[model samples]
Target: MSLAHPAHTPDMINIMIVGDSISHGSSGDWTWRYRFWKHLREHGSNIDLVGPKDTLDNIRTAEVGDDDATYADPEFDPDHDAQWGRPYLTEKDEIEAKVREHEPDYLLVLLGINDLFWYGVEPPQFEANLREFVACARRANPGLTIVLGTVLPCRKAVDDPDFGARVDACNNRLRAVAEDLDTPSSPLAVAETAAEFIATEHTWDGTHPNPNGELRIAAAFADALADRFGIGARYPRPYPDVPPVALDAKASID
Candidate 1:
């Protein structure tokens, strides 16, 4: 039931987004994952965004509730494996269980910022953790397609010179890891987000992306999916600052 083809397909592809604050997003803000969802819907792709948790970091907890604080978008399935301030090593076991439960066709991973910045995990250790994380997912689902995202640049890199080098080291190792893990049944690719998401314009506080940044991030994933797996349409940038006029909106008869 994989829609990893070009032609008009009716099958639905299950996708799971896994990361930290960058993926979890805020209460009012739309994450890159959300933008990707919109892109898939617009392109007439049958897909389900799957995850165990459905709560934004700044908005709500993962607990069930009836109030507005409980949901980011009640209509949309806000399920994801994003936990604020937590590294992949901290939640590798939980992520494995999630992969087994959801059985997603694709796993979009955008992590490592916290691991390098907060935890001060060196490049070697970070790569090891990343390798273990991918292994966990593959063990859960042998046919799963894993797309790893490069660690985005941050303003902190200016203050901490070693931070940038560490990020680069991790990304270099990540590319190698992808090459090592790719197979015919299960493929691995890297979504280049670091270059697209500049710390100045794309991010609000040198870390989290604003709306424009979100779109760019989404475009990166979309491009990767379309180019590498042929799963979805590629989304171009220059996203509108204001909402477009509704085609069906009615005007009073004059």
Candidate 2:
């Protein structure tokens, strides 16, 4: 559908991140959102991270969200629309309204793993809901560029055949969904999460990403933005640390 995007200046691009718990993140987690935020700022982009929620959920505690921004580094803008345990089926309306309200230039969407794990949504049906979500967003803002994150393999997938199959199938259909829903005005791309992320090592739990996983996922989004959308510099390294190199004159010259 050819929808009208909200008017905005080229000087500043507003972005909103929408997803489930992985993107919402709990206390003490350095979410990939933050990492990508850091990447954009490091590259000197005039961007505004916009959302309705900015609270961290303590998943371990019975109280889900404490309304505290307890990230490892509490510097970047923490605005986001992600909530813990939100069903993929219900996000269409909310996203549409939010898109119209916020009028962001890009939507970084990472969802559906919760649906696969908890709701056991089949690939076809999952794709259908995802398509609807995309249509909803595009209907709100036609110029909005979207990027989808694939379902990373979790610890439960190792032992449970059904869950593993569901994960694999959902991801495959996610790619197809990106291709099918993508348009010239609102291009869609899939973040290279499945190929680059090793959930076993990267995740603190079976599903959620740990620090290392956060960087990988962030890199996946960053690379897609650079390659597909021409947004920012390529993700420099998987880890934050850079080894200091002392090069000899000959080697340095060469």
Q: How many collisions per candidate?
A: 0, 0
Task: State the C-alpha lDDT per candidate.
Answer: 0.76, 0.79
**Cα deviation of 41, candidate 2, in Å:** 1.1
RMSD of each candidate relative to the true structure: 7.7, 10.0
- Pairs of residues clashing in candidate 2: none
Q: What TM-score against the true fold does each predicted structure earn? A: 0.84, 0.87
Considering summed lDDT, which 10 consecutive residues are worst modelled in model 2? 245-254
Give candidate 2 misplaced runs (Cα > 4 Å).
Answer: 1-9, 238-254
Candidate 1 C-alpha lDDT tens digits along 1-254: 33222233358788899988888875556667777887877887677887877666533335322112222234555677776776876766677788989878899999989998888899889888988998889899999999999988888875677888888889999899999989988899999878677787777668877778888888888889999878778886566663321222212223
TM-score of model 2 (CA atoms): 0.87
